[model samples]
Target: MSVDRVRTAAAARGLEIEIRESPRASSLEEAAALRGITPADIVKTLVVKGRGDQYLFALIPGDRSISWPKLRALLGVNRLRLPEPELALEATGYERGTITPLGSTRDWPVYADERMTGRRVSMGAGAHGWTLFVDADALIASYDATVADISDPIETIR
Candidate 1:
């Protein structure tokens, strides 16, 4: 259902996207290897619960981690924590490894790490062994995401 929803949405936008299948990747590093792309090109969709049970999505480069301070500052909240896998699945209609910003059950606020702009990115496709590739900017536009520096300091590829 989730993959179908994403396919439908992208098709509606006239996006000719490619879906790749690979071994199950339990982490960003593993996904990167399967996709033959650097970790930076892998977009990690994180489900975060902010103040007052507010759920939000943060897209970060696989090579980097989320900067809690920066995220909190941007959100104007004192704290944030990851929702449990069950809660995330319930909210997004997809499990942890299959979660994608596309076709979420709720149109939560989306924040894409600034570093992902203008690049090609890979994200989950609502199922294990499936991935969706698209222009980072286009994905952000589709999600109506706000671009910001929500990444922790980490080594970057030049």
Candidate 2:
């Protein structure tokens, strides 16, 4: 049902996408291998909290991490924080790892890193074992996303 919701959302936008399913793996590297892509190609959809209970989806490449300063400056706000897992599910109707802007409970603003553009990116498909292969340009245009340099290389990444 989750993946179906994603398909429906994409269809409504007239954007073409390919859904790929793989066995649930133990780590990002394992998941990438199962999907026949490098970890960097895997886009991580994050549910972030802004002021006054507001939320936004932050799309970052799997190998990079969100830069709080960069994101805050781009968002023109003083504070931005990530929601807890439970709150994230409530905000997006999907678990942390399966969250996507495509079929979210609310069509909140989407902020994607500039690096994601002009590439064949793999993103979450509303299910842990499923992923969506999409053209970065089409996906961004379909969502009217705000593309900017909101991420920086992780130093001692967690």
Summarize candidate 1's per-residue lDDT along 1-158 as a digit string, tens digits. Answer: 66888788687766667777767767768878888888899888999987675799999988889998999999888889998899898878889977886778887899999999988889888887689998998888877889999998575669
Clash pairs, model 2 backbone: none
Native-referenced Cα lDDT, model 1: 0.85
RMSD of each: 3.2, 1.6
Specify the highest-lDDT model's number. Answer: 2
Q: lDDT for each of the candidates?
A: 0.85, 0.89
Model 2: per-residue Cα lDDT over 1-158, one tens digit each = 99999999899988899998768888878878888888878898999999877999999988789999999998899999998999999998999878888888899999999988888889889988888999988999999999999888867646
Instruction: Tell me the deviation in Å of residue 95 in model 2.
Output: 0.9
The lDDT, on a scale of 0 to 1, for candidate 2 is 0.89
**Highest-TM-score candidate:** 2
What ranges in model 1 sit over 4 Å off?
A: 13-15, 25-30, 154-158
